[model samples]
Target: MTAATFQWLTLVTLTALTFSVAETGLSGSSILIPVLLATLLKGRLVIDRFMALQGVSGPWRWVVLGWLLLVLGLIAYTFLYS
Candidate 1:
């Protein structure tokens, strides 16, 4: 299969994994970290693949990826602390 097709499948798997973990009704950082990590991967896939930023140079991809990391890190921090 093509790279785009592979990315698409990986994205779908990550999404489903996130949902499955959520539906487990479990709690704590152990579960939270993996879910967040999966979300991070999914976001990167969407950014690089679907958004078509894989080949571009400069800071655009970094900018978007940084934004995603910041948001998700904040989320993890918030949940872990509170």
Candidate 2:
């Protein structure tokens, strides 16, 4: 399958997962795991596919991945600690 098609499917799946999380009445802390995982997956997909970073080399790719990790880490920290 094409990368775009795969990304689109992942997005749809993430949306459904979000809806399921909301409908299940789970606690906020418990819900953070899947939410964070989906966020990371989506970020990676966008970086590699849409941003065309898959074929590139060097520190730039790591920089973008690190940025994504940092943002997601902060989000998880706040979600868990607040």
Candidate 3:
């Protein structure tokens, strides 16, 4: 793997680990929402960077973007409505 890709993957992995720790420590309802969001964001960075998603064609990029948006929307609704 290229140096940049490897670096990105390492960063993403660290972010994921941090999020896991944060989730375990945070208990209140308000903190729960932010912790969950941080987890999702770390996942998004992995998919977008290490996966080389931005190098894909326009249509594929849009599809991935749509999926990301959908996921974020679901997360927002869940936290807001629950």
Candidate 4:
């Protein structure tokens, strides 16, 4: 209901998803999608909620978002290629 409650729930859901993915012992592309989705969702939550950047907009927000995307993209690329 409340914002804090929703945020906490989101975090818990993300954690559960991550744990489930790890427990499944999936290989190849099957592993990448769920893991990456969970990771990106978690990163966005931390950046927008915990970092308190959901409302304001500026270069800092762009920088943080860009960094997250870049790192995640590199990770996905590495996983897929290697």
Roughly what TM-score does model 3 have, to 2 decimal places? 0.55
Residues 3-51, candidate 2, lDDT per residue (tens digit)?
A: 6998889888987998899799997778998888988988888888888
- Off-target runs (Cα >4 Å) in candidate 2 are none
Error (Å) of candidate 2 at residue 58 is 2.7
Number of the candidate with higher TM-score, 1 or 2: 1
Tens digit per residue, CA lDDT, model 4, 21-67:
88988878898988888888888988888898877867887789899
Pick by lDDT: 1 or 3, better one: 1
Ranked candidates (TM-score, high to low): 4, 1, 2, 3
Give candidate 2's total backbone clashes.
0
In model 2, pairs of residues that clash are none
Best by lDDT: 1
Best model per TM-score: 4
lDDT score at residue 52, model 2, on the 0-100 scale: 82
Report the C-alpha lDDT of model 1 over 1-82, residue by residue, as the tens digit: 9998999899888889888888999789978999999989889889988998888999999999999999999999999899
Which residue ranges in model 3 land beyond 4 Å of their true spot?
1-25
lDDT of each: 0.91, 0.87, 0.68, 0.87
Candidate 3 residue-pair clash tally? 0
Candidate 4, poorest ten consecutive residues by summed lDDT = 53-62
